[model samples]
Target: MKEFNNKELEIVKYIKEYLPFREKHIISTRELSIEIAEKYNIDTEKTSIAALCHDLGKRYKDDEMRKIIFDNDNIEYPKHITGALLHARVSSIIAEKEFNITDKEILNAIESHTVGHANMSMLEKIIYAADYLEPTRKLETAERIREKIFIDFDKAFLEVVLESITFVLSKNQYLSDKTIELYNSLVVN
Candidate 1:
């Protein structure tokens, strides 16, 4: 078991109690997030906290997630947002309201992990790449992106965003406008 601070321990306990099924994925994400953060000289504490809470709302049903989104006045979600994309925003809210996270970067990372936006900070990139390229993902592209991260951070971020768009297109799902903006920002200008 990795050593965690009091707050992290509380978050771990919460996840174990409420979302035991997602524990493995969350740990994988946290470990990878720490690795990436260290490589880039980013704040590991914020990275770990964001990683641990990134999927905090994953287990919520769509209806429950919608209700939560509707209830939060600060959240401005697109009307078409649904499924997994909804979790990211909800998780950010939970992190703020439940865990008292005041860091804007951490909250942004959690919210943008699922569908990235333009001009993301290093912390956001670390969380986003770690979430997708964590070992448990079992995607060949993810492994390639994981390796690319150490060599060329910006390229890896771009690749991951493109890959995410490709995956969503493959699934015929509704792609978030944030993702498209990220791709354009990286490739266009």
Candidate 2:
């Protein structure tokens, strides 16, 4: 792993971050975070910070996530899958406003961790895919999904989108346009 800048070092308190990410995934955070840094040849510190805070917004209740998105963006969220879809953006805003986290790399990774984007940075892709495929995930095809994180990220994203589609279809829920676009785009990719 690469060395950390002082600013980067300050961002991750090390001990606190180690458990939240590790505990949730059932993979020791230090081990998993280091694996990402080593596999991607990135600074472990930055990876540590990004992995640590990737799900900060998920800590907000579904209602709170909606409230944050609603108040910050002037867009009222209807009841649906939007809270999870929108949390990435809302969390990035909080990272900046509340946490004093302004590193665009970190913020973007946090914001785009849900609903994979068209042109993701390596860090963004890593965080997004890691959060989804983390070992603790127990979705039907989770192991299959984990296999595609690097081998074919597009497929992994397609699976994520497709799962969301199936879920909405099952419940007769309204689908977000972004979800529709993503689903169609992945179908062609």
Candidate 3:
């Protein structure tokens, strides 16, 4: 196993520390992410970093996510998103500026996973799809989506986006305009 940089190493430590059941599984989440990357023939390092850092923005307590979006270069992130929706955008921004994540695929996959984009790259589709269908995820829709992920990634992505929108609507929450637009574009294209 290749050793990680200080920061990457810290990330590994944090995942092991924070995520539940990581130790019980034969493959660490980081290793599983890399394996998923390899299976899809994507860049292993980029996927590894993106997968590890996907939840970085969830560190926020007491509107910290809102504060970062506010402080960023006039990015104008809407305050409507609460709960898990906030992490996707914040992690993308943080990774781009702070963690030196230059791969557009990695950044975009992180940004859009919570509400996927239209016409995503294969790598983006893989990460978004993998995160949703990963064995640990236990949402009501997990089994339904897993088949699409294995049988058809594009269809799986569409289903993921639609499902997210449906879930948000169920909770009476606002769906990001980006999400709506992406959904429409995907349906149209």
Best-fitting candidate, scored by lDDT: 1
lDDT tens digits by residue: candidate 3, 62-159:
38777787787555555566747777778788777766778887888788777776667776666676666566656768667765565665677788
Residues 1-189, candidate 1: write the lDDT tens digits: 447999999999989988899999999999998988988899999999999999999879877888898899546556677858889988998999999998999999999999888898999989998998999979999998899898899999888888888889999989877888888889987
Q: In candidate 3, how many clashes are counted?
A: 0
> lDDT of all the models against the reference?
0.90, 0.63, 0.68
Candidate 1, lDDT over the whole model: 0.90
Stretches of candidate 1 exceeding 4 Å from the true structure: 74-80
Misplaced by over 4 Å in model 3 are 1-7, 15-36
Worst 10 residues of 3 by lDDT: 20-29
What's every prediction's RMSD, in angstroms?
1.7, 4.5, 3.7
lDDT at position 144, candidate 1? 84
- After TM-score superposition, the amount by which residue 177's alpha carbon in candidate 1 deviates from its true location, in angstroms, is 1.3
By TM-score: ranked, best first: 1, 3, 2
Q: Who is ahead in lDDT, 1 or 3?
A: 1
TM-score of each: 0.94, 0.66, 0.77
The sequence of per-residue lDDT tens digits that candidate 2 reaches over residues 63-140 is 887888778878786676666676677667766775687788888878766665555676766676567556666666
| Model 3 local distance difference test score | 0.68
